[model samples]
Target: MTLPDFRRRKAGNQRISFVTCYDCAFARLVAQTDLDCILVGDSVAMVVHGHPSTLAADLPMMLFHTESVARGAGGKFIVGDMPFLEHRKGQSEAVSAAQALLRAGAQAIKLEGAAGNLEIIQSLVEGGVPVMGHVGLTPQFIHAFGGFKVQGREDAAAERILADAKALEASGVFSIVLEGIPATLGKRITDALSIPTIGIGAGPDCDGQVLVLHDLLGFTEKPPKFARAFGEVASASVTALRAYDEAVKTNTFPTEKESYA
Candidate 1:
């Protein structure tokens, strides 16, 4: 879907379904499904590459995956995730990074934060780049928060997130992602924004929901609490491999029909 269609979903009252994938294979596979959006999320730092956190992901890595996913998307809208410093340092850097991501085939770029990132978001949008803003328990800010903790539990913090979302909207973000917040707060932000509010751990009140493809398929080693596995692909794969190994060891795998010669 295009950004306009994605934005329209909020007023249309149509719930969206977004899934995150980092490689060309999954992107192509998901594009064939009923998903409304595909995100080349920075969470790949952990899910794909085995990094401890998103902080380990960089521009080159994100670019490589962005291009790969784009190749497989078949013209579907793909949001390339901006790694920490790509937008944090300054507007010029953010623009440069965004340009790279666009060239790499991302229809839009998503950055974490609102208050500190308003300038970057504004500059990008003004320069003809569409952006998606992320707020509430930003992973890039994990150091500051000490971990991936839920946010907006208290009145003051909830107000801060609301303010952040407003600032981001004013900065020209077409949509926003609300992560790790309460359902009430998620609904509050969704109601306040004209654009769509996509939730991860923020709950069912959002305009849409997104989840990592790995977690959704039960391929992740330790899935997060918010993730629900629809299929146990990992365990099934293990079992199949074990059966193959046993077949080979027992010399029962190659029957007359299985033999080419």
Candidate 2:
């Protein structure tokens, strides 16, 4: 979907579909699907490289994945994550990082949280970088949060998140990802924002919903409670491989017609 489609979809009351994929192979598959966008998320550190968390994702790592996804994503709108502190360093530093991400093929950049980064976000938007804001259970603040827990649960915290969402919109983000917040709060923010709200564990009231490709495909052994696995890819893959292994062991593969005549 084009950038304008985000708002148009929201206006039309249509729900957007977004999924995160880290590499070209899956990106090619995602491109062929009806999914609206692809995010080269920092979750790559955990999903692809076996890191314990997104904290391991760095500029170079995100760049590499963004480049790979862009190469095979066709016309899919790609949003790359600004790994960890990439945006907190300073305005110039954030712009430089965003420029690199854009050059590496992200049409937009998704940064976690709105507090303490409004100025930088405004500068990026004014400079013409499409920024996607993320708040409420930002994974980058996992330590501060003590774990991957729901955010904006209390009245005070909910008000803060609502305020942050407003601030982010004022800073010129095209859309915002409302994550790990209560469904009511998600609807509240969605109603409050002029731009689209993409939900991840934030509930169905959002303008759109996003899921990790692995989680949706059942590759994740233990996905978040909000994630729904629509396909049994991991188990099917293992079953297929086992069949191949048995065929090879029994010399039942590459026989007769399968071999060069």
On lDDT, the leading prediction is 2
lDDT of 1 by residue, 1-261 (tens): 887897778788999988998999888898788888889999999898998889988999999999999989888789999998778777678888999999999999999998778877888998989999999989999999999899999999999999999999999999999999999999999999898999999989999999999999999887888889999988999999999999999999988899897
Candidate 2 C-alpha error for residue 223, in Å:
0.9
Q: Which stretches of candidate 1 lie over 4 Å from their true place?
A: 253-261
Task: Give candidate 2 regions above 4 Å deviation.
Answer: none
* TM of each candidate vs. truth: 0.95, 0.97
lDDT of each: 0.91, 0.95
Name the best candidate (by TM-score). 2
Candidate 1 residue-wise lDDT at 48: 89
| lDDT of predicted model 1 | 0.91
TM-score of 1: 0.95
